[model samples]
Target chain A: MTGSASGLESPAEDLLKVQDLLVHFPVKVPLIQRLISREKVVVHAVDGVSFSLKRGEILGLVGESGCGKTTVGRTIVRLLEPTSGRIIFEGRDISHLSQSKLRPLRRRMQIIFQDPHASLNPAMTIGRAIGHPLQIHGIVRDAEEVRQSVLDIMREVGLTPEDQLFDKYPGDLSGGQKQRAVIARAMILEPRLLVVDEGVAMLDMSVRAKVLELILNLKRRHGLTYLFITHDLATAKFLCDRIAIMYLGRVVELGPAASIYAEPKHPYTQALLQVIPTPDPDKRRKKILPRGEVPDAIHPPAGCRFHPRCQSVLPTCGWEGRDFIDLLDEHLSTSPKGVEDDELLGSIGEWWAEGFEAGRKTDAKDPKKLVERVKEILAKAPPAMAQAVQSVEAKGEFVIVQFRTPDKLVHTAVADRTVECLLYQ
Target chain B: MKAKHSDPKRASSLPEIPLPFLGRLIHPLIRERRSLAGALSWMGLGILFFFIFIAVFAPLLVPFSQTQPFASPVLQAPSLQHLMGTDNVGRDVLSRVIWGARTSLEIMAIGVLIALAVGFPVGLLSGYVGGKIDRLLVLIMDSIYAFPGLLLAALIAAVIGRGVFNIGIAITVIYIPLYFRVTRSQTLSVREEPYVEAARALGAKSHTVMFSYIAHSAIIAIPVIFSLSSADAILTAAGLSYLGLGLEVDTPGDWGRDLSDAQSFIGVGIWWMSVFPGLMIVILTVGLSFLGEGLNDIINPILRKERS
Candidate 1:
């Protein structure tokens, strides 16, 4: 009964393949302001991310908030349109398909949201909420049949006293009951692929384990494949078959669940795994904490986005002129007495940085004096940054500081696994 | 734990005011809000039901036929024989005012129904589709909304010409934008709720999502608006008739037209002709408004949830 419907298709084939999917949101500006500036800004979310899921596989997309894991799941289900890239589901490219064309495909895939209170309509009774999807997809026509099927699903999701809870609204139920009802709504149609987006994140800790167990039981019973999105690595370890670590909208590392936990290749993945507390008192773990906050996606750091905070950074780590500008700004703000000229101090923000070169026009009396002064400033940089700074020279009235450019880290094989870092390369 | 337990005792030292049984009966209404809107609503409903009774049994209750001319001495003052006295045409003023209830209620109820019928679907489409069609319909509704209700009613009345049905149409036009604005805005917000999105994600057709999820949830506030709009409808219809733009001069029953005819007699001290008709208008409108306010008390969960 479980595999009879989809047995003809090869089990070894990929169920869903995503290639370089990008979902960028264009920042809206006032009409007059936009016309005068002629500049278009966009939030680079879910930039150049790719992954594939096989049938019966539960792939976890784990990352911090705003890492675009949720966006990736939404794009796969066609909830949010992708700005670019292909999403091949069951060998069909559904990347840019129209809503009408996607309607039939929606029956095969479903999404369970995090907040169960918000996911179900407040005005609708629990019975109607669960059974409505069945009626909509033409799986059941009669109201009584719909009710019986909904009750069956409710029982399957561990919601008992089905008769007592049938006519109750979402407001009447507890947090766990609400979530169980939400799961019943998603599973009533028996979709092939379910995208669970932090589905247990909002439930109580006591109820979390039970709901997770229920999800696993349902997956096995129905032979359902899942693309589980969560920030909790512990839950992902318990649930996901394969884990992909996302950093600034890119899959920095991906492999089997056990291997990622035992030996994380990417610095970002290692930092995440290190934070999990172990119960053993004798073993003191050396925690690798990344510096600073996740940078704004609008102006992501040049080269590798994690390079600015990477503990194992190399001399060629994707540092651009902006890095120099940031360093200069920090120096000026901390100790301002070194620079006396008001004009030069006021014009420091006018410095331009791109690629590996950063420069600013100076109003100095002599070019040689400005060159000497710029070199003195570069000398005060930390040892790592000082080594990366190749040269400082004054050309006419412009002082240019250049840094050695490192190669961008593509997905490189690390033994049996894959990682995106200069160290792995 | 001991300090927390003593806090309630300290707060309870202030004496509590004892409420009467009637006060306790309506306690839910005033417990959280501290508003007179609830009290006024009950008063208004009482006035409205009184007129509904008058209108329903106008013939049986009246001493004389409202349409019969010279049934009594013209300019007769209030007496046992004539409770509200006679009009300028010698017809019974009390009977005419009683019969006027039927006319006013008909225009108010039917006109609001017409407005809701026309405005709801248009608002749904304008809000749901939401681009060029939305912009165009919004522009048209805003133009109508810009005018004062009576002035708009007059303008529409002049074009459509006057009679019972025409006056109803005029009032309908005046209030259509109110319904459209309310329903459209409600639909706009309800369309964004996760439940509506959940329905769409389940492969529900556009119509199914619109009717089942969006419309069902969005229209909760509509009934609250409906009662209030009907009250406004009564005032607008009366205004149109007061300007001689409603029923004909010899019409048997009309508050606005009667008020118009009674104005000439106001200079002569024949107060019953004007006062009776004007008083009925006030009572009926007030009744409708109170009914609306009362419904608001029950329908709004935000107000009800806090106390319960």
Candidate 2:
């Protein structure tokens, strides 16, 4: 399967390179500027995401919903423009190319959509729709050649009795037939790169496996580069050689599919593995129950993004100033907003002072030194708008923030397999 | 992707039924009492076709020279000498009616045809290439749709000063927006379809995708709209004659003018004067409406899928 990658990674034969890509969608309210100005909150849908495909590597991006897996796939193909990123395809900077400039490139990259029924035009006969690409790319001159090419591709996709189906409209085909017609259309141009966005997600379970096999077969037959995006890791394991696990708009785990699945590094990956239903219940194992719903993208948790849900959270997890405020906000069960109602803000200030005082006790050996540190923190006035300070220090050792942020992505850690969790540290 | 070896026999048996899908697609027309409306349509159209055939060959069919005036009795009423009862001018009433069919259908078909030719392309372009082009076409068409179709046609006739072509060109101007609007909407939805995207991926130019993929969906709706528009055109032509803006008042030979003048005689209880022309309008409109419905029934998506 990876023999195709040799052509892709070779500088002369490279197909596409995606580097540190970020696609932030600014949630806009129609006709209301004052209501939400630099109030312009950005959903880090795909943040600092980086990956590259050698000529034929099948890179599977696996994640749950809102993981930005789909965004990465689309941005790399230039289907959707990246907010800030570089998409180098065969040595050309295609990231911001205009529609006209992108025309020729489109002939080399194709996408097979999820909804088979919605993909093919109901008014067009299979032959016209399939032959459409051949004529558009100017690959075929004669009308007869175009028809013959469509028939050949239709057969390749396992559409048996292709001649009989030629004159039929998409509305006539069943789910499987429609999907095959779509592949027939895609393969007509023999694109170098194919983005299959959960391409088989919509099919019945029985149909899903067969479709996946067809894609595998096509890869061998055509030497195609596939960026298979799916929330199903199991499918990724089945189809991809190397899999990247995405979380909160970033890749937190990636490595060889066989290696990662057997020795999963990311706690999120482990939790996901446990959830896959086993047909044989007798073989079921204890599932890891990660806490909390996925946080709002607009204002994510400060430390590790997964801190709130990670069972093994470290206090040192990306706990910066934002993490402090988030914990105070969590404690009050209220957000601090008004300067006039400075009471909540004051309490948040005191909370931080108390947190520092506790840290002093743990670091200091002498009781007198600990007391001096607490006095110093209390003596200083709280910052403006940050009015008062809350004090609840027992033995005075640690401040408890609500959650922790996982420090690194999956591949960055040098474990035998790429896993994204503090436990590896 | 292959069907199972023992896939339910009931699913396979579905082809025997007329495909329940056909019923769903045509269900709206049935509910609209369109199927019944079709009866009035076909019966009327058959008469119109017969009338047109006779009118085209009036001299040959009727065996009478319209200009050979007063060769027979000056006035005759329902005798072997004449079928419908002759006028004071001594012309056969049947021959005039037969001759009149030419003017009646000619104006109607020509006016509608002109509207479709211009409106279809405008609608197709406006819809597929949305944004400035679409907005501009939509605004212009909407303006025409906003104007009352009859009043607009009348104004165009008056301005042109006089001619059958003027009436047709005017009616087309007012109703092109209808075709434009329908075509644009169909294009919008069709463009979003995967097949269109597939075409784009395959490197199809904007024009190829627009015409090859999007325009065909809009074609289905044209028959229904065109038939109805022609009905309106027929009435418009008649109104122009009523206003003395059509076919010239000196030529009392036109159906609309004949109907308009007969209205003055309505007070004298001359029912035949108003009745004949009124029936002509009703017959033509019914004919077009039935044909439209029949087309809809035949091409209805449900039925189309069933046969496929």
TM-scores of the candidates in the order shown:
0.90, 0.78
Q: Evaluate model 2 with DockQ and give the value.
A: 0.36
lDDT of 1 at B255: 91
How does model 1 score on DockQ?
A: 0.38
Query: Over the stretch A1-425, how does candidate 1's per-residue lDDT look in tens digits?
Result: 33633642788978899999999989988899998997678888889998899999999999999988988988898988999999988778899998888887888889988888878877677888999988887889998999999899888998889976887767669999999998899898888899999999998888999999998998899899999999999999999999999988889999899899988988889888888777796786788799878988887877788887888777777777887787777767787574563444345677898778998887767666656656766678655666788888887778888888777678987876678888867
Clashes (N, CA, C under 3 Å) per candidate: 0, 16
lDDT of the structure predicted as candidate 2: 0.68
Q: Could you tell me the lDDT of residue A280 within candidate 2?
A: 96
Candidate 2 is graded, for docking, as acceptable
List each candidate's DockQ score. 0.38, 0.36
Instruction: Provide the overall lDDT of each model, using Cα atoms, as 2-decimal numbers.
Output: 0.82, 0.68
Per lDDT, the best of the predicted structures is 1
Fnat per model, in the order shown: 0.67, 0.73
